[model samples]
Target: MASRSKLNQICQFCRCTPRTELKKCHKCGSVSYCSHACQREDLTNHQRACRVAREGVIIPPLDFLKTRKEKERLTEILTHCVPRLLTALYNDLARWMEAKSSALLERCINDLKLRYTPSACETHVLRVVVSRDEMWPSSTSTPGELFTVTKFQVMDVQYARESMVLWKDCMRELEIQRREAKANGLGMIAVVGIECPALATVRLLQFTGVGRYLLVTPAESGQRSHRRARR
Candidate 1:
């Protein structure tokens, strides 16, 4: 049973305003305070919640295209190895698909660009199909071929997890590369995808420490799209 307050008070530590009685800490439930100011005063007991709350916030994606400095850095990275790596990846897949060369690679990159750009049509189908009846050639054979469909399915899940881990690693490496580029007075571009509000807050904080930020929402069609189309 909890006693009701005249006005529902939020916890100063976690900023949680309970609709009902504010009896316990929403985060740790270790200390109880009636108002936000009171919760802030209890530094000793609420420190854990403060730290946890900080970590819970999400960071938004970077919009490197808007910043000239960021764009330059990103271009440098793309110019070096990234585009080549992507080309190789696409070429390998296309080779497996019995395509001539890496012409499809450019198409895949265009599709990725179209997918990211607002108001762009989504007609590209990026799918990989494997035939069970046909025996895979030695060059195309992977560990996935030996296992049965059920086992291969499990392996595919594991591979997806590993790929996500690799993607995160690539992001970290890119951040380091961007920092180096900035040190040399070069512009860099970072494209980030923020799914949650917490992520958006975290990204703002992170970018603020690095440099200034100008928030840009997805632009609507008309003038903006016409400009993008021309570019």
Candidate 2:
């Protein structure tokens, strides 16, 4: 761990701390930035440690992929693909905000910090389909997709117990569809919800030519929301 004086030193990107109030990186709870622009500038370099810190708290499910080969592929994505995607996503987010996405992300991180543990906040379900290219792939093209995602968030806040119920519902629905698709030789769909302290992303993935589908739900049960002391 860095010394207090080191963390208190000017922005992580540039030495501007003495001139301004510094804010710590909420995700890692380490390193401080004097401004959003400095945070954005330092993001690329900061992410290596940022990801390490986040993963230290929440290990990504690398074993979610069924086969050894699939697991390896997923590992490759987590190692190479995810960082690039996150960079782009963060950059886009930065463009939209007056204070930039880092500030927004900090607020979100703090909002869920006490109430949600990383482990409790993530869920993924997988099913096998017959054909890969047969289903509608886009969430926009598919009706009720947004509504379903929104409803999941609402459930997290309101009917927290129903979070598992919803997951089971999605699982059962996928199973039924998988069986039908297998009989007809068709493709499957998956919903993945990952709510990172730094960024919350719910993705609906459709493989163009694969049989496996995964669903990740964004709901964390109320039971788990009870705060756990940091080890």
lDDT of 2 by residue, 35-74 (tens): 8888889897777678778776333655456788987787
Candidate 2 global Cα RMSD = 22.7
> What lDDT does the true structure give each of the candidates?
0.38, 0.43
Evaluated against the true structure, the overall lDDT of model 2 is 0.43
Q: Please report the TM-score between candidate 1 and the true structure.
A: 0.20
Q: Model 1: residues >4 Å from true position, as ranges?
A: 1-163, 192-222, 228-231
Best by TM-score: 2
Model 2 misplaced regions, further than 4 Å: 1-7, 57-231
State residue 75's C-alpha deviation in candidate 1, in Å. Answer: 40
The TM-score between candidate 2 and the true structure equals 0.25
Worst-scoring 10-residue span by lDDT in model 1 = 198-207
> Which candidate achieves the best lDDT against the true structure?
2
